[model samples]
Target: MAVLPIVITGEPVLHTPAAPVTTIDDDLRSLVDDMFETMEAAPGVGLAAPQVGVGLRVFVYGWIDDDDVEHRGVAINPELWLSPLSTAPLHEMAESEGCLSVPGERYPLRRAHRVILRATDLEGEPYEVAAEGWLARIFQHEYDHLDGVLYVDRLDHTNAKTAAKAVKRAGWGTPGLSWMPGVDDLEG
Candidate 1:
């Protein structure tokens, strides 16, 4: 598996909705494997297809603690289902968040304390998983990318301003604040 180059902020693709994956074929499996490797290489908690320039509804991540075992894998066409608070498991909102596409920055975005997801594995097997805490937040964050939403978009105005300054200074424009793909001129 290869560690793919993550598409940074300012790219038009990140702003647009990602394509859905209809086939769970060999190619799809390979892409998932590569994504896992890429995520590990970058030492990140999650990675999405859009981050690697593949505008498909796919992502991979796992719950790993200080233990050496790094449980990791991929999710295809992931759909999140937030459990009802009444019968659902209890959860707590954790804020610290980051994105591969955004790069060199992190932000605090409020995310559900817990969540349930229905998705297919790389081999096309269906699975349902319930996660909470940081795992839940990470999955939610990556899933947002599949919908063309970035963590920055979820950041509070004050936090967003912090990122905006960094983005402007770095001069990265693929998926960050400075670039808008369809909008020829943002300031009319």
Candidate 2:
């Protein structure tokens, strides 16, 4: 499997909702494998297909729980259910998250503390996961990508304004922007 170049925020594919994966063939399996490799190499907990310029509803995640139980899998054509977000203020360091597409930045955004993720696997079998804590956050973050929503977009007024400035400063916020994981010095 290869580590694909991850597209940046202004890329049209990332801002648009992804298409469903109706066929699970070798090509899809290979894409999943490559996504895993890319996510690992990017040193990110999760990744979505749209981030890699593939407008398909698929994502890969890998995270180890506090008990050291590893959670890793591909979610194809996923349907996610989230608990109501707490109206309480963001916990800053605890709630801040980074996105590979946004690159080199983390912002505090409120999110549900629990979620249920249901989807098919590479083997074309259905499965579900009930998650809380960081794993749940990962699922929500990646799921947002499938819906064409970036974490920065959900940031509060202050952070959102700052993020917009940063995006402009970096010469992003346009199409045809991408970076190779291992090859680029930037990481998010």
Give the Cα lDDT of each candidate: 0.75, 0.94
Best model per TM-score? 2
**lDDT per residue, candidate 2, 72-157, as tens digits?**
99999999999998988779999999999999988888889999999999889999999998999999999999999999999989
Mind giving the per-residue lDDT tens digits that candidate 1 earns over 1-188? 78777777778778778999999888888888888887776667888898888899999996575556555667888899864434342222336666766665877667777898788886688898788767777888888889989899877688889988987887776443432222222212
Query: What are the TM-scores, per candidate, against the unseen true structure?
Result: 0.82, 0.98
For candidate 2, the lDDT comes to 0.94
- Displacement of residue 17 (Cα, Å) in model 1 is 1.2
RMSD of 1: 7.3
Clashing residue pairs found in predicted model 1: 9-173, 9-174, 9-175, 9-176, 10-173, 10-174, 10-175, 10-176, 11-174, 11-175
Clashes of 1: 10
